[model samples]
Target: MYDRPYPGNLYIHEILNGHDVRAYNYFRMPAQVFTGLRDLLADRGVLRDTRFM
Candidate 1:
């Protein structure tokens, strides 16, 4: 996926570039909240796998 974040607060197709990065996609827990955390850490590649949450 492209590294470009959505220009505004609203995140639609243009932000994720076709990937279903919505909160509902995650398996366990509130999709929206966890997805936000995941996006901040995982999708952005900010934290390494070995790093503790």
Candidate 2:
């Protein structure tokens, strides 16, 4: 998500809540995978907002 900046945000000039919902779907991804992706995003300077994660 972070890699894409406005990940999953297709709306024109609107906040993209799709990625948030995707991340919130715990059943979709493993906990470790989600954490790893989040960390990766943070490390790569994609996750600028800590509160978002």
Candidate 3:
């Protein structure tokens, strides 16, 4: 998300941190892949039996 430093950076810096700061962006890349896997698990009804549901 460093490459997408438009609204994302602004939002994190201005709203989240209240100033310029370095922080991890949990919105793209590996996060997206993990979210996709979670969605897939939900679609397969696997998470229905787990606390993740």
- TM-score order of candidates, top first: 2, 3, 1
TM-score of every prediction relative to native = 0.26, 0.42, 0.36
Among all windows of 10 consecutive residues in model 1, the one with the lowest summed lDDT is 7-16
Q: How would you encode candidate 1's per-residue C-alpha lDDT over 1-53 as one tens digit per residue?
A: 33556433234333334344543353344545555786789867885554223
Q: Which stretch of 10 consecutive residues in model 3 shows the poorest summed lDDT?
A: 15-24
By TM-score, the better pick of 1 and 3 is 3
Q: Which lDDT values do the candidates have, in the order given?
A: 0.49, 0.51, 0.48
How far is 10's C-alpha from truth in model 2 (Å)?
28
**Tens digits of lDDT, candidate 3, 1-53:** 35655654354434334322222243334444555776899899886543322
True-structure lDDT of candidate 3:
0.48
Clashing pairs in 2: none
Give the poorly placed runs of model 2, Cα more than 4 Å off: 1-27, 51-53
Question: Mind giving the per-residue lDDT tens digits that candidate 2 earns over 1-53?
Answer: 34545634233112223355444463366545666786899999997753433
Clash tally for model 2 = 0
Cand. 1 TM to true fold? 0.26
Judging by lDDT, tell me the better candidate of 2 and 3: 2
